[model samples]
Target: MPTDPLERIVETAFDADVRSCRRPHSGSVAETAVLELENARGDVPRRLVCKRGGASIWTGDAIESAVLRVLEQRSDLPVPGVLASGKIVGERGSARETDPLERWACYEFLEGTNPGPGYATLEPTVRRRLVADAGAHLGRLHGTPGLEFDRVGGLARGENGTDLVLCEPTGWHAVDSDTLREQLPISVPPTGDSGRRPVLTHGDYQPSNLLVDDSGAITAVLDWGNAHVTHAEYALARAEVRFVDSYVGRLSRAERRRLRSLFRAAYARYAPLEAGFDRRAPLEKLRWVAQSGSNYARLLGDSRGRRQLWRQFRRLLE
Candidate 1:
């Protein structure tokens, strides 16, 4: 009975064959639901998740579908399978029908909890292991030869190792120029982009996008709306800064050391960073302010954090 346009669209797209449609996630950009799809007799239930495009095809479900297909085939990573994809069927002879990219997609629902801002709720030891696991998996993701491309950033065709589509890629799941503009590259020493080859990056590799099982094991990585074969370090830096800051909250001296030691060791296990990478994390953390800009500013969760981010941006500029 939800009147939201996204809910209506997803319902229409799936038709009236669903047993239940429980919305599990929603944000400014996208909406998600867990559905129990059943036959007329309410038998043979299939759990499925459907994500609606945020505002445009490029920034929403379409990009995710492409990325999921690639991940499902190439990596052993627990990404969902693309069950269906298409634009909502309606508007006969309307101008919207002409666009092919503006489509919605569905995936098989993986069994796990998406622990968004609540990641801090887990036991500290569990959080530590989960973070380390995420780092190691990222290393494997970056090393996939099938994801290698000669361009700056773009998406791959399903797991067949086909070439990427977009060349000068923006932030994943973001088709908007403004959000993309803010995430622009910034120079941070040590893990700088100098000699690094671009690799497949889950542009917004944060907690909400991760699914964890009951034992605190990461079950599936979700949402490639911002994925691209780009400077893997940029992605890594964003991952380290965003994940550590948001999940750990106000990092003390010990927390900072723990963050650096654990993430670097785990990440290096899969994709080793160059020597002296640890020395550059403070610098990278600052650069994260400039590149992420207002989006990260909002994620900072308070006026003081925003001011500090702004001050850091100004200082980094000088």
Candidate 2:
């Protein structure tokens, strides 16, 4: 694809006085372009990020843009303001065929830098604070009420909101699928019905999705493509695992304990889970971890033209 084509699309889409446009390599799935718009007619200069869908993954960019627009109107949480979103017609190759890509979204560019790899080397106190902040933000997001979106609300069960971490169909991860029909039981069930509640959650809560400013404060959370309404404990469990993995090397034993406590304590304020019902009991979690190694092995299997299905059974032993 021609690089300038994306810039031209953005320019025409917004009709703003654009100064320059450059592609950014930060995102994994989308074709992202950062555009700088010139200030004119009393309009302030602005930075915008345009995201277009790629071939491999399901582009939920349009859904995310719609959801964020709703979330932005509310004052309780922090979210990037969405500017515009629509399809950009383009011809691929000599076929005179115009492909209508279903997913496209764009938002105002956030100015702060990502909290660098220094997070991996931070002191125990700072690490704990990061986890606490993440947990707090998550609690706030889950606590905020009454958000409605057509596409997000329509996400298939066990698809976006529910953590199907363990129940993904065998070999489904190797290539994306429309529907995965494996309903493995929760590995860790909550003690009682206390943990279940109707609430909003940032379904994808990994550390890379968070944006920390230069002052070490988390300024904004990005990537709500997977956001949805679900049980609050499920969201907490996902966040805790992500936090532990992100700071595994830097946290001392005591620090890890304190961080866990902080996260649980904060999460409990808004949506409390049952006590004593091992929080990590979801079978899906173990299945997900095992699938990671399984995916790795599958890669090797493909290179050698071999089929492997019992990798998970073997992974269970390791």
Candidate 3:
């Protein structure tokens, strides 16, 4: 009934008095805040990051908590520890469709700064190390044993309630196959159930989700809302676009290539990319381009963005 229910949830979940609660990030689907905690016997100060879910087409706090648990137990990736998780009291109507409870997961506050949006604007040496470190961490994550699945989708509970299963990928919008062909004028074939085993991927892997210290070392990887089961190479291809190619209109061809090289080289130390990656990357990258272009076309009411994406998509095809 209150305007914000997270404070109540935090107090109930941790049984601690809150010093301050400040929302650090609030998106369409979730609100995240850093809560300063004060317990009865003040041994030491504590800070926790609490994420409360809102309506969205993506997996919510439960899956995020599960994914973090798996990573904490299985891999060396520096993800925030799940300190407390529970449903937000009296906040049911604003929940995700798949999940009944408007769940929230609080994490032990990780130290570092989010390497903001200006990846291309960073000093060249700093950019190089950060990219390489991110690539290596991703490689290690994909290589973590026993995380493989058979399909592309978000992680969900199986029928028996003990195992994990695949559900529809978050942010996967329905695109008409017939119209896609007309827009690109090229055969954008569906990526088949490839032979490669699917692995858990950081669904929204980008610079924003990574945190770094002053020395540019990655101290933590944040945000698991988009983690999904997918082919590792497909994920890598997507990363190449986000980590490397997203700056296409601005960065020259050579500059982009250099960044890609740094990323792949670091990634290769942990896991080898499958064969024919170059040929397959374009196809994989097109999937994102089309989906994004479709969303853009809806907002712009013109073909300019689509046409530009078309040119870029075609270049990748070549």
| Top model number, TM-score | 3
Give the per-residue lDDT digits (tens) of candidate 2, residues 1-318: 224656656566665566777764343234567777764233333777777643211222235665676677654566778766665644665222222233455676776545434566665565566667787787777666554221112222223422212221233122211122233233434322445454556656766666765444677777776555544555566577677644666666676667778887776665455775354424334433664466456544552112122332343343
lDDT of 1 at 103: 54
Candidate number with the higher TM-score (1 or 3): 3
TM-score of each: 0.72, 0.67, 0.76
Candidate 3 C-alpha lDDT tens digits along 1-318: 223577777777767778888865422234577888787244323788877653122333246666787789889999989876655445446434335236677787888877855677877788778889989998898778777665566566444432455777544323323345556644543433331446788877888788888667799998876567766766787888888898888777888898898888788788767556666578667776765555455434534334434543554454
Model 1, range 176-287, lDDT digits (tens) per residue? 2223334545333322343255677886777777888766678988777657665656567778876676545554567656865787677777775866555545544555
Q: What's the candidate order when arranged by decreasing TM-score?
A: 3, 1, 2
lDDT of each: 0.61, 0.53, 0.67
Error at 161, model 3, angstroms: 8.8
Better structure of 1 and 2 per TM-score: 1
